[model samples]
Target: MSIDLKTIKHISKLSRISVDEKRAEKLAGDLNSIFDFIEKLNELKTDNVEPLTSVAETTLKLRPDEVKSKNIREQIVKNSPQDNEDYFVVPKVIE
Candidate 1:
């Protein structure tokens, strides 16, 4: 696959980037090189390879869900600079 000058201009327009006539021609060449590299990668054989999530095999340790701390809303809210009966209070912004 290869990119053309007209396609490069269209891409520049879509990306909202300003490209001079000379730069557009250069961009087309760069895009063509990228597509050529991708085509070369496509020729590689990976039939026996497994999709990898990480470089090494490891297990993530998980703990059983249980309540570790008792609720202390009253004690926590007692020292608040601004708080309501059950939540923090903030200055109103809208009129």
Candidate 2:
């Protein structure tokens, strides 16, 4: 697709950017170049090519899931200023 000054102005307005006529012309040229490059890339045949998720072939190492500590809620809750059997009580700040 071709990019003109009008298109550049419209894009600048939508993006909340201010652009002068000279800058707008430059942007139009730059956008046209980018679109041309994309068009060239689209012309390449890739029907047999597979999509790659990662460049590396190695699988991620995972650690075994196991409990490392006993239930310590009662011991920890003893240090709190105010706590019930299962929760900590805090001052109400909101209505």
Candidate 3:
């Protein structure tokens, strides 16, 4: 799609931006150049290309998940401002 001066003016007003006549014309030209580049890219043929995460092949290292600490609820609750039987209590944060 082509960008016109009227469209740029409307967009500037909606975004609370002040663009004088010269800047508005300049922006329209820049936007038209961007659209022209996109149109050129659309002429390419890529039917057999595979999407890639990276240009090179590699493996991600991972560690085994294991429980390493015993439950210490009572000791932790001692430092809190308030606590019930097995939980710590704090002020409500959301409405």
lDDT of 2: 0.91
- Pairs with backbone N, CA or C atoms under 3 Å apart (clashes), candidate 1: none
Of 1 and 2, which scores higher on lDDT?
Answer: 2
Give the clash count for model 3. Answer: 0
TM-score of each: 0.71, 0.74, 0.72
Model 2 off-target regions past 4 Å? 74-82, 90-95
Q: Summarize candidate 1's per-residue lDDT along 1-95 as a digit string, tens digits.
A: 77888898888899999899999888888888999999999999989999999988888999999987798888877776686678767678898
Query: How big is the positional error of residue 39 in model 2, measured in Å on the Cα after superposition?
Result: 1.0
Put down candidate 2 lDDT per residue, 1-95, tens digits, no spaces: 99999999998999999999999999999999999999999999999999888999789999999988799889888877786787777778899
| TM-score of model 2 vs. true structure | 0.74
Evaluated at residue 6, the lDDT of candidate 1 is 86
- lDDT accuracy of residue 48 in candidate 2: 100
Q: Would you list the C-alpha lDDT of every candidate in the order shown?
A: 0.85, 0.91, 0.91
